[model samples]
Target: MTANGTGINGVNGAAPAQAHQAYQYSKEPLGNPRPIRIVVIGCGVSGIAAVKMFKDRFHNLPVELALYERNKSVGEPGSRTVTQGNPYFSRVYVGAPELYEYFKGRADAYGVPDYVRLEHKVTDVSWNEKMGQYGLKIEDLATGKTITDHAEVVINSTGILNAWKWPDIPGIHTFKGTLLHSANYDTSADLDGKVIATFITPELALDLAPKGRDTVYSREEQDKWAEDPEEFLKFRKRATHILNTGFEVIVKDSKEQKETLAMIKKQMEKRLSKKKELIPKLIPDFALGCRRFTPGDGYLEALCEDNVTVRITDIKEIVPDGVITSDGEKVELDALICATGFNTGYLGVSVAKFPNYFMTTGPAAPAAHGTFIPCIEAYIKYAFDAVERLMREGIKSICVKEEAVADFQEHKDNIVHDFVWTSTCRSWYKNGTVDGKVWGPWPGSGPHFLESLAHPRWEDYDFKYRTGNRFQYLGNGRTIRELEGGDLSWFIKKGPKHTREELTPSTVSINGL
Candidate 1:
């Protein structure tokens, strides 16, 4: 469709011939901004940051907000959305408890808890055409009752890691040993002298003690960071710069990818010196960055223990004793842990029919790389900018054009194969399909993603006005900004700079010609 398909004219996509119905407005003054009710789902990192933005960063806007989180407390029940690591931390690794405390503290600091509805789950949402708002069906988990609510805007941040999945192995539930899924692990389970099998990281299958774990900050270093803010800022900048610019590393044959492949192979081989036979099984043949990679401080050494047995073959069945391999061997164990990863499909979810809202950190976003917080913050800012326009202007509904989304999808798909995620490795980014669509990340670098979203394409959206006469929002020939004592002449600017001779002798030059 062409750009003129927005149907911006009067009723029936046609303009009036004359002053139809005498302007259809009373010419009242455009007073203070209208109140907008915004509902945010999931209180993970995205939800917390969104709340902070609404409550603290955008206090001036007339916004009514509510945050719905499924978890009753800060941490528990699937661990929600914490993932990956950052370099700027005092240590490279961060635990779930620390992240939970950090978000909890922010919730208290900004008084976000006041607007949070804990233990509430949003089951369904649809547009209420009559009321010009969104209708939501919510489930109160504690009461087992469904409730109904309405909001002008809904921001879904439920995150992708909430759903834990198990491998589709036959007779999986027939095992007699204590079975565990990493996402829903039981902390009280005892494994002191019993054999354990793991389908994920090797360290989880054994009691092999790590030789050394030094991912903590020294006393002096911590003191220095506390004493000098500049040092901290410098370190943060350096780390963020590296993270923001490392997008090229995922390119299939890029120099960075080759270097990373060599480095990872060297690290793994050195750690597995005693058991060289396991190297071929553990080391992946595909290029690096095709899947999520971490430093894994002590994971390699833990796998080198004498008692540890690493299996890479496909599972045939889950016998009463243990897992049966395709090669006809049954490995006995007292416990089994399945770190089979999450059902990450929700991370990049998109619903075409839904209106008056958009996803943050969604598919085709730069979220798959870099420090995720920056990406989350950027997306929130972008989403709220639309929310501001909807509240400030007399807009009934606004959503991206179908053609625009199609174009974006086609463009992203054209360039996605250049990255490592589309290589010969199975990844959650592709929903575990080796050749499936890549939807979890932007096709460019982190900075490029930020810059592109900094300026929203207002024309790419279809905006429906609240009034019959589109110009009714002009209202009394006075704007809210002007009423708030802003500079009335702000739109006026000096003309282009001209030479003195050209400005003074225009008449003489005409006469001579």
Candidate 2:
């Protein structure tokens, strides 16, 4: 982890040979006479990656970059705590290595701040066409000071976990012991010896559980273990029992969608009739893989500890001291942790949420293949190659082609259909609308994701200005200055020299394993 001379070469142990080649700009040192003012919102994985890429590629080129985060530090919000604790499950799971390699160089050059203001909350966004800029209205949570940030380019990488969704159960707030959400879960020490009931599905259960721990395997593994039918049956029954007790799933019928519900009900009847034992396994009341996998490491094992109990019953209401179940029984508890996940179908500032894409076939998008898309790796490679080609021809900011979305989704749908895991149980992955429209850009596979982000393609989008003016290409020639323009001469100025210091470990932790 030694800091290399160049900003982008070091950090996270990336292979030197694979360091990203810096992108060269065209005729004008910068396309416009003004400094490219870029504002990045949220300091999560994607936001950090985008900012670092811009800095590494176009360092000291009159680029004013600012990042706004609601949290106090980078990688502390959402699932960041989970990933930092368990790298094996997260590193490859979410394409972290690719992000690391992409952003490392820039972080070395301009190190990220350790702490930021955590009290500001943005309420509204407005675009000022006359000023040719965007405005974000925010309120300071502590001081109540209202402030606005105006910028030319604003990136909304606010992430998916900012909002939490609660399940609508009758009289939930009426009887309460100590109800809380999983978002606040920082440590398992408090639950070391406590009764815990998880109202979640199998897909979500897997995420909360340890790695490689599942209720049952697919047919391939079943066949391998079936040599001893008697033993295998015992294990199978135990696994099913584990699933039932591991989490108290509130099997909400998918009848919310009348057509799909009727179809599922008909299929369930026949399937259940043929094999009653398979009822719990095959027919999930909620659609399978509609949510994220909820990981609860040390949760079930904690139940075996003293002074702990696990209940699998419908919740009736929250009473003062305990929870009343629909089965006419009340369970006494000290506290209750609601590991109820998040809502995914509708994201704020979403392209679908706002009709801003109407200018052309669509608004400007980053080349599709280079994002997190798994199935379109080859297409991403083609896209990145085009970006390099375009860079040679003097084009800097490349937008994704509108048609690429359709093309990418076509492959995503195919990948979804071929996945056996998708048919396992209901969760957030399929949190699509009743009409079956996807929300995010890509599926959940790392290799495919890396391939997709490998490069940019110029043909996919109509690269143009967000402002209502045609950009004049000067091809690396230094442009005539506008009043508020940033000067490249500042980069050439001699910076203050500093002595190198020996690196030392700052702190140690038990969870660093």
For each candidate, give its TM-score against the true structure: 0.85, 0.54
Candidate 2 lDDT over 64-122, as tens digits, reads 55666665545432332222222222232232233344334434444554212345666
The count of residue-pair clashes in candidate 2 stands at: 40
Residue 191 local lDDT, model 2: 61
Per-model lDDT: 0.70, 0.43
Question: Native-vs-model 2 lDDT?
Answer: 0.43
Q: Evaluated with lDDT, which candidate comes out highest?
A: 1
Alpha carbon deviation, residue 145, candidate 2 (Å):
2.3
- What are the per-model numbers of colliding residue pairs? 0, 40
> Which pairs clash in the backbone of model 1?
none
Off by over 4 Å in 2: 1-33, 47-54, 77-110, 114-117, 186-198, 201-300, 303-308, 345-403, 421-424, 432-445, 465-471, 475-513
